[model samples]
Target: MAIALVLVLVVVGSVLFHVLSPWWWTPIASNWSYIDTTLVITFWITGFVFSAVVLFMAYCVYRFRHKEGATAHYEPESRKLESWLTAVTAIGVAAMLAPGLYVWSQFINVPKDATEVEVVAQQWQWSFRLPGKDGKLGTSNVRLVSADNPLGINPDDPNSKDDVVVEAADLHLQIGKPVKMLLRSIDVLHDFYVPEFRAKMDLVPGMVTYFWLTPTRTGTFEVLCAELCGTGHNFMRGTVLVDTEQDYATWLEKQATFAQLSTPAKVGALATPAKDVAKVE
Candidate 1:
């Protein structure tokens, strides 16, 4: 009786808690509401299975409780029950995977108009690269990363000369404009995530990963490195500001281009362009 009561309580309590929990996902600020829908479907399916299995166990515990002299009845297996379980499990798995496949398709099919922005990550800091007047991002490599060129833009690539760099600063985006975020890592793995956006992708060394989204509203959102990095993992924080066109244009104008940062005023001294981190706040 006690076991049965606890099982019943567990099911009822979990459902109520989930429904009433104050800690819910932050209000979505981007165009990935479908991701939230997928999560809800997953929760409902898993919750139902959990409740059913626990209730069945409670029934078994009470019904098969030891009696004065009840003889045990052993059945090696039930083929019918096995088939039913197998079919249900397969259906549940399919229900979860089908939505994921759909979401993945939408995620990779970036629109042509989506502006590309590069996000570079290291042990604990994030940087950004945006196309300059040429509207094209330049070639980059890890080997080219240095104190002066933290983003490693290839100097030889003429296209890179005009690429704007926003190192260690808040990324600003024009609201309602689609953006394709290209992810890169200087060292180990890192994941660019913003809870409000519901879109994230990992940055793998020597390779680039990407995802696209359009900010649906104007607001300042928090950025985080979802991957477990080094000892400074917890401090890997950044910001993404979704702004009106005027505000975004104003912010972009203040950033320095690759040529500006790489240009040496004299023989051996590179021009020290002002950093944007201080100005972005």
Candidate 2:
């Protein structure tokens, strides 16, 4: 009787604590509310199963307690019981998985008017690239990576000349504008995650992966690396600022284009050597 009472109390206490828990998810800032809905569904289904199983165990223990002169019966060949257990378990699992599958389908299909933004990840840093007046990002080549051309933008491409390159800086997005984030890793693996946004994806080397989100509010959000690449993974943080339309335009105007940044490097490369200058003199 005491054991059964304790089991019942455990279920009741757990449910009460979950309902009144002070710690909960952060307020969502993006359009992934369905993710939260799916989570709640999972919790409800699992909680129900847990409560039922534990209560059943308690009832069995109390009702079948060894009586003073009771003899143990051994008749354990009930196909009906096994079949019922199997069916219930299958139903429980399917109920949990169905919502997640539906949400995942919506996650992958981006809107037609969404703008593209490239996110470059290294072992310990985050960088971003935005389309220029041409409204397109230029092709990139790993071989072209150097001190002057860190992002490896193809200099020969006319489309690349105006691309806005923001190296290890805060990324600003205009509020309510849908953006498709293109993720790439120059070194090991990384993940771009913002808690408020509630969406994240992996950054793989030699391949580009992507996801989309629209900034529903204007504020500064901390960017964290969800993957542990190395020792510095803990410090690999960045900032994302969601701004109004005029503020976003002002920030963009202050950023230098690929051509503007590469001009000095090109000039230095084309400069005549000191020895050649003396010979010419």
Candidate 3:
């Protein structure tokens, strides 16, 4: 009796803490709300099953307590009860799996007009590459990286020459537009996570991963590095700004290029012709 009471108290207290706790992922503001609702349903079903089983066991102990001359009742399991329990379990499992699979399908299939953006991860910083007027991102490789080539743009490919590289800059997107994020990493694995957005994906080196989100609210959200990469992992923070179309364009224009933004220009300067130099002399 004492043990049953203690177990009941512990379970109730734990469930209450989880229900009333202030700590939780920020409210869903994107398409992930469907996922959150499904999670709630799962929790309720599981909670009910746990509570029912434990309470029934406790009741059995109290009602059928051992007496002075009472013999143990040995009865095999009933097919009817077993069948009902199995059906109930199957229904609960289906209830959880149905929504999960549906949401997963939606998450993988991005809208036709969704904008594709490439996010590259390094040891402790984040860099982004936006497709230019061509609406195509050129190929990239870490092997092409050097002191002069931070973004590893392929020199042989003219398409990459016009790619807009945003280094250490906050990412901005137009509000209400679906954005498909292609994640890559130059070093170890890292996870791109935003609590409020309720979306996250792991960035693996030499492999392209992806996630999609449509910003419903226009505000600045913190981009946290969820995976432990190194000693400086905690400081690996970034910002995402959701703004209006006009604001997004303005922000994009202000970002300088690798050549224009570098302290010392890496692109070779144009040579003065022999005649022009002689005329100056």
Candidate 4:
């Protein structure tokens, strides 16, 4: 009796906590609410199965409790009952898998007009690159990186020369525009996750990964690194600012390029050969 009462209280308390909890993924802001709905469907189906099975077992335990001289009865499986249970299980699995695959399809196929942006990750920091007047993004490589080559910009590629690189700055996007993000990591694996967008993808070193989302609401959102990179992993945070077209354009204009920021005086000083200069003097 005491054990039963304790179990009842525990169930009630857990239900109340689930219902009253303030914590949850930031309220769905995109069309991916269907994902959440599908998840809830799975939850319900699983919960029903677990509760029904346990309660039925409990009922059998109480109803068929060993009474003095009570005889035992054994029977083989009933075809009708087994068939019904199998059918129910199949239906539940179908219900869960169908919607999940549907959502995954949508997540993979990005619209043609979606704006493309690149996110570059390094040790404990995040950077971004946006296309300029041209709609193409230039290629990059880790081997070209050095103190002089901050972004490892492909010098041979003319298209990369004009690409705007925003280092250690908040990424900006225009509202209602589908944005496709290309993720690259310079060092280790990291995850680009924005809870409000309901989407995320991993950034693997020496490879490119991608994801797409359209921001329906205009606001600043947090960009968190979901993968464990190093000791400062928890501090790897950035911001995503969604704004109007004009605002986005204004923000884009403020970004400076590697060449533009490099001073001719400094470049000449670094490029001068020591032996040639000494002979000239």
lDDT values, one for every candidate: 0.92, 0.91, 0.80, 0.81
Shift in Å, residue 209, candidate 2: 1.0
Q: Compared with the true structure, what per-residue lDDT tens digits does model 4 show for residues 1-281?
A: 44444555555565577679885568765556777877788877887676666556555666677799999888677899999999999998998899899888998899999988999998798999887777778788989877766667776776776688888889999988888999999899999998888888999999999988888888899999999999999999999999998998888888876455444543354577876545544
Best by lDDT: 1
Tens digits of per-residue lDDT, candidate 1, 224-260, equal 9999999999999999999999999999999988888
Q: Could you estimate the TM-score for every candidate?
A: 0.93, 0.89, 0.86, 0.85
Q: Model 1: what TM-score?
A: 0.93
TM-score of 4: 0.85
**Candidate 4 regions with alpha-carbon error over 4 angstroms:** 1-11, 75-81, 258-281
As for model 4, its CA RMSD to the true structure in angstroms is 4.2
Clash count list over all predictions: 0, 0, 0, 0
Error of 3 at 192 (Å): 0.7
Q: Which ranking of candidates, highest lDDT first? A: 1, 2, 4, 3
Better of 1 and 2 by lDDT: 1
